[model samples]
Target: MHKHSYIFITFLSIIGLLVSSCQQQTAQSDEPQQTATPKDSTEQLVLLLSPDQMKTIDLDTTSLKQTTIRKNMLLMGKVSVSPTHLTSLSSVVGGHIKTLHIIPGQRFSKGQVLATIADMQVIQLQQDYLTAKADWTSVKENFERQQTLNAQQATSDKNLQLARAEFQKLNATVHALEQKLRLLHIDPTTLQADNIRQTIQIYAPFSGTVNKVFVNTGQYVTPTDIICELIDPRGFILQLNTFEKNLPGLQNGQKIAAYTNDNPKAKSTATIINRVSSLDDDGAGIIYATLDQPNPTWVTGTYVNADVAVNNYIVNSLPQRSVVSFENKQYVFVKTGESSFQLHAVDIGESSDGRVEIRNPAQLADMPIVQKGAYDLLMAMKNKPEE
Candidate 1:
């Protein structure tokens, strides 16, 4: 009986051990399981300064503004004269140049005598005209006499016909000579035996500055030979080589300002007259602009710089000093508290006319931005001790 009591006690001890084990398991489950505690990511860079510190830093802040910025498209080009403005004069007849009253770079008036050519052919033409005119009178008198004789039945019809033929032939010869003399710039009615001239004076067709001289005194020339070239400066233009991307912002009649490297302040005004797509290479085209009131000092092939206003837009912006650079990024200080600011990163667009475009303005949340002395805040943030 004592041995049986010992076995029952042992079973009771084992049962008590199982109950404690179950209770411990239940307590372990009931207690909160250990999990990774989430790291704090709510903190940001903030600068806190006293009122005197702000004043000492020369810090200024203002609200974002809608600014109208005028952008310009720059072009490199050269000044040149239009093709229509250049004129070339040639000789009418082949002859030796007698005298040249003009030289290259000299200005001349209209109807001015440019040169004279002495030609034997012109003299022979005049002599033939006088001879034909003199023979015409005798032929006419003989024809009249033959007509009177034919009426009196003293001359045959054949004789009268022969006389009439001679008269018509002589008349035709005289008329032909008159026309030939006129083509030589000689007046037919004004020409007489005593007033015949062997030289023809070439007159200026238009007034302009001589650009090139091809012939000198006593040099023989042909009708196809060019005597000299003239240019009218009033038809000057600016030509630019522009890429295809620039076409969208350009059009005819747009005004542009042009200047040279020698003098930038002396700007020349011009208006776009045409755009040519021919001979386009590498997606480039030619743009032509008429220069307004071109300076007398400027000549063709002058290197010019042109500025065309384009892509005007009204965008949210701030002063250039308002934005600061940090870690190869752009930042602006946003006022979050009376004396505290948060460094806010922003996307920027074009910068011009002392203003910079705020591309991601929505991120600002209508916060006031630190202007004028934002760099000071950057310095302060850099020097601040870690929390």
Candidate 2:
């Protein structure tokens, strides 16, 4: 009986010890661990700020609200001159450039002399014209005399016929030479041996700024060579490349807002003049638009951003300053709790009147956003915690 009681007492003691050990472990597990593991980088970004810091930054919150906004297709393009407004200048006849009055960026009007070319061919052409005129006059006089003789029966029929043929031949030569002289801008009626010129002037066919000069003074150029390039700034148009799928949304006479990448505040309005139906190798289509009011300051080849209206509807939006851009992704802060904000990635659209349109409105509906101090929250969440 004594052995039995001893064994039973020992078993009871062991059970009490086991229960005590388990209770100790339960207490330890219930307490917070000293070392906390950091979350994965792709997980939700969070920021914890002190009350004083939040007050100092004057953190403000705004809720999502519905407002009328236009759906716009953001397009990237460049300024281009119309084909008809641009031209390449060249001489009709080959010659040595005697003088050049055109310099890069110089503006010239139609019929203005751009340069002068000198060659012996021009003088020779004038001389031939004078000689032909003299010969024609002599032959014509002889033909008249023969006609009178034929009527009087004083000359043989063969002689009269020969004189007539010779006169006709000389007349044709005179007419051909006269036209040649006119082509060189020489008036055949006023041209004489002493007054013939060895140079021909090149005139501007239209008014525009000289963009480039190929030939310098005293250089020989052929008719096919390009003398210079000219462009009219007034004919500047905006050219944009869009996908072939967007063709149905584009049309003639549609309004477009254009601005350069360097200066977004300096915006200009334009109207769609054309939309090419053909698709390029990449399935891209070209859009051409004319400036509503042309400006001389708009230079050709300048990169521009255009907002083409696609549709209009009510959207939730926020102030431009409420959003932050980091790592090429746009973000905004949502006030999850007092002194705590959650960073959320958002897809944004066109901005106007200091407000930006949010593409995903339902995600942020009825939620308070960090409007005033969003950047401060972004820095706190993005930066690593201090040691």
- Specify the highest-TM-score model's number: 2
Structural similarity to truth (TM-score) of each candidate: 0.56, 0.58
Q: Compared with the true structure, what per-residue lDDT tens digits does model 1 show for residues 143-219?
A: 99999999999999999999999999999999998887777779989888899998988877666677888999999
> Over the full model, what C-alpha lDDT does candidate 2 score relative to the true structure?
0.85
The regions of model 1 sitting more than 4 angstroms off are 1-69, 125-189, 276-283, 311-387
Pairs of residues at least 3 apart in sequence or in different chains that clash in candidate 2:
none
Question: What overall lDDT goes with each candidate model?
Answer: 0.85, 0.85
TM-score for model 1? 0.56
| lDDT, candidate 2, 168-214, per-residue tens | 98899999888877766788999888898889988887777898999
Each candidate: how many clashes?
0, 0
